[model samples]
Target: MSQPLTAVSLSGVTKDFGRVRAVRGVDLELQQGEVVAFLGPNGAGKTTTIDMILGLSKPTSGEVRVLGIEPRAAIARGLVAAVMQTGGLLKDLTVRETVEYTRSLFVDTKPTDEVLATAGITEIADRKVAKCSGGEQQRLRFAMALLSDPALLLLDEPTTGMDVEGRRAFWQSIRQDAKKGRTVLFATHYLEEADQYADRIVLVSHGTIVADGTGSQIKSLASGRVVRVTWENADTEAITRLGGVDDVEVRGDQVYIHAKDSDTVAKYLLTQTSARDLEITAKGLEDAFLSLTGTTDSTDSTHSTEGAQS
Candidate 1:
């Protein structure tokens, strides 16, 4: 297959706030029409990297480019739009007015009504931004971002504070945009959203990228195998005897075995008398994430397994 078109590229990028280093030696690439979910904990340098890419903050080192042009230049040409954490909408302005006002800034703007409808906010088009709840205000901002028909959309925690129905609505709209060859760089703390929306994922921790790949790829870093231990009268010693079992923890009657081949181990446990009632399952992405960033030392490579088993 032909190489994917590059929408955004950052090489050896670094950003510093005074004496503190926020983003260090970061290198990232976003492809045309691709959706990349940027994942990290609070203060993990996610926002800092996004700010640099958006030209809101200058990088301390290295180069950053968007759409073959600097992000600042892209913004000038109305090729990039951002949905920041604060929404940034005039509280008193109505939704239609907000979209219309932003549309005026761009020479080629999506029609106000069309933008409202695309964002699922047409019913509330005439409502003042201040009157809308947090989720509605966010949807309004999303409508404004699309008003310019930007090629690259930068979203920081876009679905935050939205109800389940609202989030589903927002993503449905975003998926339509992706189908049109628009690139999206989304920053979110919600891993499930990343798994669902992102074609690829970049995991950051402590001012550096710890992992970058598809959800399965990242999960494979720590091995994508869960050890589900079920027992009738599961004793701690009996649970530990299962071969290939790594970390074993018990809660109530269930024993959680973090292992490589849980299926084989569960069968092995079944042979033992203590494991008369036994069940074992596989691991998931959540385990990989917790084992990596959630551990005491974020850089530990103890659990770094190569490719995932699918």
Candidate 2:
């Protein structure tokens, strides 16, 4: 089967700040009704790319389109709704009042009760925004965004302050929105969140897309099974004798071998007289992300202005 036409497309997009190139030659496509998670370390230009797509920042070079027209044009039609990291609703207004106010801006809005329920904030709908907890406030923000019934949802860390259950509830609501053919582009620090909710994952590093595909597809890039073995001696000679193991590291009394096949490699290790205890493990998404991004926590760079409301 053929892939569907994309809802948003970015081609050869580049953005710069003075002498620094924030985002460099970035390209991305988000399909209609598809949920894609945008991931990157702090300075990876994930926010810059999203800003370009949202038309908050103009790209120094390249093309960006959302819902067929330009992103700004889409926003003008009320087809796109964005829930930023901060400040989308009135701080003084009650949760219900905020929803009602945002609803007034859109011709077609979801019912306040329904939106509150969808965001798992029904109980606090009457509470003042200033009095709400961080998670409650996040839910209220989402409720306000969904009030417009947008064709595309851009959520920047939607569940940042949510607990486990709240995050699950928020994702359930997102899935329901996707079921109705809405496109969702979310940025999250939680790997498991992307693995569970996103149909495709996009990894960004140094302002460019380094990896993009399904979770399992990206994980496949590592292409190695993990073998755990307990050796009598943490010696190089014993480690070298294990065939088919590519990356070998010894920790205390145990050794980890990364190989093509864990079972086969485990059997080989068992053949050694010193290999009394051995275990095999599979590569996980975290390992894949670290391998692909290779980003240490030092290069954090992103600045958001609380200047406008989308």
Candidate 3:
């Protein structure tokens, strides 16, 4: 059998703007038909990397290929499409008209009705774009993107203004499309969505790829448990001095302790300190994100300016 094609590939990719380096030397690859989540905090070069892949911006160094060809070439052939967070909509047109207008820009296109239904916006096709809610408008954008029947779909914060039901429906459409051999790459602030939806998660921090794995595997990288207890007299400094403790936070009477040896911390909290109602749980994706990205630290100046253009 022939080898599966690579949908997107970045080798030694780096991007810089003046005095600041936005993206460090990064390498990534996504196989065809994979649903991958590209995750990072603000100024992490996630958007910059996406721009390079779309051929909207050139990398200061390295190569970006889409479908084994140049990014722009693949895009020009209607093999790749992107649904951005905002803009590209005409308020004066109805949803159907918006899609039809977009279709006109292409040499060949999927049926407008089919795209609308696939995007779950067929029922609102007659609604005026200006009158549509944010979620509805985003669905209209999805419909517009699907008009090309793209093999690789890049979604940048695709569900930003959507409600709970709207997000659910939107992802359902993406899942169905991915099942049909369409590759989907999305960036979102909602970590739960990535945990639930993505086949794999790629985490970038300070313009570099830090963690790449399944949600569970990423969580394991945190390597600790969080112990929560109600202790009015908890001393943060004292807790930090503990052998296994990594960090501690006190919120009102609730004290949260992150520790590698959770058993020892729990025992000490129950027997030594006035801490009560102790609960110990494994670190979650949020914990891993904060730990791996150094989001809680104020030391990295790179993030402060790297995403200025993002």
Which candidate tops lDDT? 3
lDDT of each: 0.78, 0.78, 0.87
TM-score of 2: 0.78
Please list the residue runs of candidate 1 whose C-alpha ends up more than 4 Å from where it truly belongs after superposition.
1-5, 224-282, 294-310
Per-residue C-alpha lDDT of model 3 across residues 1-310, encoded as one tens digit per residue: 8897899999999988876788899999998888999988877888889999999999999999998999989988888889988777999999999999889888789888888887788888998999998778877887888888899999998778777886788788789889888999998767898899899999988889999998889888888999999999787787787798988988999999999999988887788888899999887789899889887773455666644565
lDDT of 1 by residue, 1-310 (tens): 9676588999999876656667778999888888999988766777778888888878899998988888899898888999976848888888888888888888888777788887889999899988998778877777788878889999988887878997887788788888898999999888899999899999987777889999989888878355555565666675567666577777876777777767766666767545545554555777677776664554422122100100
RMSD of each: 7.1, 4.7, 3.8
- What's the ranking of the predictions by TM-score, best on top? 3, 2, 1
Clashes of 1: 3
The alpha-carbon deviation from the true structure for residue 61 of candidate 3, after best TM-score superposition, in angstroms, is 0.7
Model 2 poorest 10 in a row by lDDT: 301-310
**Best by the TM-score measure:** 3
